[model samples]
Target chain A: MKDTNDWKQICSEYLANVDAALVNATVEEKQQILNDITIHLNERYHELSDEEQTWEHYQQILTDLGPVEDYAELLNEKSPDKKKFQKHRKAFWILLCAGIGCVSVLACSIGFFSHSAIKKARESKRPVVVKTFPAALDRTVDPDTTEITVTFDQPMMNFSWSWVGGGEHFPETTGQPRYDKERTTCTLPVKLKPGHWYWVGINSEKFVYFQTAKHIPAKPYAILFATADKNGNPTEIPIDYIEETKRVNSK
Target chain B: MNFNNWKIQLRKGLLELVVLKLLSSGQFYGYEMVKTLKTIKGFSIREGNIYPILARLKTDKLVVIEQQVSPDGPVRNSYAITEAGRLMLEKMTAHWKDVIETIDTLTAGDTK
Candidate 1:
């Protein structure tokens, strides 16, 4: 059962990475690529025998698909006039940077007062996690809890969120993360094992998709909790507590 | 360059041609196209690599995609070659034949 779940987790993570790599594609293009890949994966997975359905075997399938970033490069190459557009955009940025450099020199000559103003604006705009369903560091969350809800202080961009963290400490997500209609509260469907400790991070340094409408990433937050056993008893921490905690913290 | 690397590059270049030729026969879903290609010895391609080519062909008006419902599963994206694709394929095939003939003529005197 655990092996089956692990393979599913691997598949989910692979798809998410592919989605992340397609930064330059249009919405329609990204959707089509993802949809086609999903169908291919599903069909191949179903072809595997029960004994061959392990994570290693699933990873072999992903290997045959090639690296995820290559898809982005391939799409960019195929898109008409992409190279020309990129070249023009590069020149525009270079010119803009030169102009900014001149303005910066002038600002430094005059007081450089805008530095603190810019910092203040950034700090004010940064989003925060207002609340979580089980609340961070809860010791006795019900094992049957099917979802983790995170509420943000400000509205977020739809389809943008990073439920970051991995390994045995991380909860296995069953479905994609989704934002509420208001785009503030995001829910991630998860499967939790009884008496197991789970840690989830929202927006790490690398995977910072939990951004506000203005694209300011939320402050990194960790949700650590342990599920109660069938008897509703808070079970003892598993033997790998220290190692798993270290792994989660490192992320 | 390594022989394997050369073969890989050659295969990559020929993949677009192969996909067009496959679509010329009949419409196929992304998975079906990949499976069929994998059966061809020298023409085998990574499963994920086919989609981008198909997407590019669609963008170039060489192929059209249709949403199809599978009898046992979810909707599938089926691909078929357009008239423009057939014309392009004809030219590619002719060019390929010429290249093969030229190579054969050039290597005809080689003892090895």
Candidate 2:
């Protein structure tokens, strides 16, 4: 028959004492005692007719005799001295891994902001600096020729830009020039096939360091920057044609 | 004789051996086995408990089982030890004797 109160109450109250006292009893004797208790409770429970009274009587009996869990604790007096310590270390490792992940995310955010701050300082001293430019840009692709533009953190003025070098392999060295109030705003349009690549650079040639997109030259190209003082003295930053590097698909 | 709780004073672990030695003698039904077993004062046990052991021994082929119709209109399976069981019984007997001798030697004055 189903029990009204959970077995835990029985285990908690009487199991330990019973197990200790009855350790010498045969298996059958122990089973018979448990069986007796079950039958006794069943009879009282059915006779009471009142569910609450039945429940109370059952619990009263159980609260008097503890269960196997209590007895097992006594039996385990010989168990480990290391299990407790191992439990602590295992908990620590889980917490440590969680801490590392949090630290990594924080470090990544700090690194990103620090790099941005350095870039701003570098840009402040220069009249103009180029961030990126086209690789060996193709010289002719009808409309396939991609435009190479220079980007700056701030605006620049009084400058002209030109690109040269259109050769089958350096023979058709065609050159063109363009002008704008701002070099950062100047866009150089060129025509090139997809396979024909070219390189171009931006240089104000003063107070600012110039960087070009150095990559495998599809078809070698260069940019000329002419920034001058109060006079019309052109300081030419010779956009020399660098040879194309072979494209290695590292991936 | 505190009746020494047959369970408590029955030479520690020799209760099963005592049972085995009895079974080695001849075939007997559950009630008969218990009746005979109780004759040895401290060896009293629930007769039903032997049924499970008998079932186990029969399955192990350590004991053979044969059923006879009882007046109750039901069959009673009697148990008799097989050759292997008898051999096991001999070994158990020898082992128990050695155990007692060793225990006596070790316990010395503690022997009752």
Candidate 3:
């Protein structure tokens, strides 16, 4: 007859060994384990036959193991493999974040320098641009069509024109509207609906100077008019690749 | 009932019994087991934990599994108690009751 203390130790050993055994304890072995424990408990219980009642106390402890296997399964949920995966995942994220930070810093540095260069360029290009289109003022037109005339500070090559307003009221015309290897006087024909508003945006491929890095034409790209004013004067409207203003009179 | 020991283990264990009792009632898929167990306080379970023991029980054949298709995907075979499982539950429960009564009677200090 094992003492209650011994029975207690046995139960503890069983719990501790249970996981190891469960790693591969056949049902028979587990059941045998359970039986051995019971026999141990009962043998103790009977030894205290004079106090058979004391044996009853261990019965609960004995029955409880049945349910514990279920609970042990619960604790196993946060398995080591899963934990390792989470650690690897965390490291991967750290590396990814570092990569992103590196790219961001590189981009920011490039942007800062490029912006500085662009600002300097504008400062330098502004004077040259002004010299080319010194008469960057609106010329009023009254009917039939608007005539846009440009004078360059120097002879320019490769002149292009594109119409950007009033839907089909005035379709954009492109493909080297006209080129002047001499006076650098560039002009384009803009056809528009009378009594409608429109803008003719022009672009030239000439570098503001004979030696400049940029060839972008200036803004408000030569405003034109498709609409006739109250006095029949042409009223200019800005247009681009955006939708046309319902050609109030594409006629 | 030691506040910090065996009785605590027993209190925590009551839930396991309820789950086993339920499995004894009929086959229950893991989720189904959880749904049933939730109502009983100690038995509230983390779903993942149930499978390993069920697996062990399966190896033990004290509990057997029956696989069935489910829209949620391949469902684990549900657990059902075996005759040996029934016997075990019966014997353990008998021991559980005997112990409880003995404790009650002894702790009450009423030999009668």
**lDDT of each residue in A48-118, candidate 2, tens digit only:** 54445543455444432222222222222221323454567689889998998788678777775455667
Cα lDDT for residue B36, candidate 2: 78
Best by DockQ: 1
Q: Candidate 2 deviates by what RMSD? A: 39.6
All models: lDDT? 0.78, 0.43, 0.46
Model 3 ranges off by over 4 Å: A1-251, B1-8, B11-16, B42-48, B110-112
Model 2 interface Cα RMSD in Å: 24.4
Q: Pick the candidate with the highest lDDT.
A: 1
The CAPRI-style docking tier of model 1 reads: acceptable
Q: Which parts of model 2 are misplaced by more than 4 Å?
A: A1-251, B1-15, B71-73, B107-112
> Candidate 1 residues B1-112, lDDT tens each?
3454466578777888999999989999999999999999877676788887777778778999999887999888999999999999999999999999989988986746
The better candidate by lDDT, 1 or 2, is 1
Of the two candidates 1 and 2, the one with more favorable TM-score, higher being better, is: 1
User: TM-score of chain A for candidate 2?
Assistant: 0.24
